[model samples]
Target: MDLDPRTGNWRGIHSAPRDGSLIWVMDPNCGAFVMRWDDEETNPMFSDATGMWVASDGSMTWCEDTDAGPTWWKPCAQ
Candidate 1:
């Protein structure tokens, strides 16, 4: 991950190729998960999605401002 001090923004990469060019932020209220990847060539369906995550359980759900419903997260594997 790299931080741009001027904008207080971040960029990062993961092991998977599909996990391309990530943008990140911290939820001021909760101080938890908040990240996005909107590049069309990388991720299409979730282009503008944003979500919170539970590290302990590996769970997340994403929704957009205009979305009628939040995207569902699959339960953690046993």
Candidate 2:
């Protein structure tokens, strides 16, 4: 995945896996942030529904409720 430093947007070079597992990377060449879902975890912070996403750089973000849905990504509080 590649993260745009200017927009905080990302795109994956390859399609993400279908399995319910999470992936994270900290390499500069691949950008400093990466996250995927894992369904087996019981913690809300790890749940695909209400998980807290933390980048390798220590930045965090999470989903928020909206008319569109719970897919809106909001920056975590410092």
Candidate 3:
């Protein structure tokens, strides 16, 4: 995926129909990343305030904020 140069909106790499554009915002103070789609506000994606990390072996780890708890993503998914 890439961002539209003129609008800063992200688009899917493929030509398939997309649900909506995603927006990512990072809060330096809180060290959390937040994601939102063009039309949704009631259910936005959010990461924990602990920050995200990528291992040297080409894997990533992070957590998503949700009602259940912080959803963790480990290197195994990579």
Error of 1 at 75 (Å): 28
Number of clashes in every candidate structure? 0, 0, 0
Model 3 scores a TM of: 0.20
Q: Estimate each model's TM-score.
A: 0.24, 0.24, 0.20
lDDT of 1 by residue, 1-78 (tens): 223323534222222122332223333233323343233322245555443222332344323333332222222124
The sequence of per-residue lDDT tens digits that candidate 2 reaches over residues 13-67 is: 2333425334442323323434443333234553545533333343554232222
Q: Which ten residues in a row have the lowest lDDT in candidate 3?
A: 69-78
In the range 6-77, model 3's lDDT, one tens digit per residue, is: 343322222212243322332222332223222222221452234322223323332333333222211111
Alpha carbon lDDT at 43, candidate 3: 25
lDDT of 1 at 59: 45
Error of 3 at 37 (Å): 3.5
Winning model by lDDT: 2
Model 2: residues with Cα > 4 Å off, grouped in runs: 5-9, 12-15, 20-36, 45-78
Position 39, candidate 3: lDDT: 25
| TM-score winner between candidates 2 and 3 | 2
